[model samples]
Target: MIDLNNEKLELNYPCKWIYKIIGKNNQDIKKAVKEILDQREYVLKLSKSSKKGKFKSFTLELLVHNEDDRKMLYDILYNHDNINMVL
Candidate 1:
């Protein structure tokens, strides 16, 4: 039996990474991402929003140089005050 908890995902370096950034407002999230990325090349698209328009999600796609680079980006987005979640 494979121990899923002990397993890791194998991914090639310099690959495309996608992050779903969620926030209260799409405009605010867009501004926050611009500030956080700061000229870094990335593709941001409006993915979805809550039925009542309380929450919004954006898809952030970018090329990550390596595993560390990918994780670092995730950490940064997850820690930002403007971002509620990063997945």
Candidate 2:
């Protein structure tokens, strides 16, 4: 059996996770990443270093509320016109 009080306790704080965002261009990458961070109610920990190549990438660690919140974040990123890919 589960305790109602315990279940309520779990909902008190936001959950955190790391997301790696890969895109086609540097400007678009930064713009997309910033949009996600700014538009959502999340705390972001952006990667300081990224490998340089044909594609631009940034690793972002986010402290979100739950799985749904994460999915929303992904949806926003994926929908951005400047963003070609996200991982």
Best by TM-score: 1
Clashing pairs in 2: none
lDDT of each: 0.91, 0.66
Candidate 1 regions off by >4 Å?
Answer: 1-6
RMSD of 2: 6.8
Per-residue CA lDDT of candidate 1, range 1-87, in tens?
767997888999899999999999877898888988896899999999999988899999999999999989899899988899999
Error of 1 at 65 (Å): 0.6
Q: List ranges where model 2 is wrong by over 4 Å.
A: 1-13, 39-52
Q: Write the per-residue lDDT of candidate 2 for residues 1-87, one digit (tens) a residue.
A: 766764543443376666766666777677667765776544333444445565655666667787677778788887888766667
Task: Itemize residue pairs with steric clashes in candidate 1.
Answer: none
Q: In model 1, state the lDDT of residue 2.
A: 66
Tell how far residue 40 is off in model 2, in angstroms: 5.9
What does candidate 2 score on TM?
Answer: 0.62
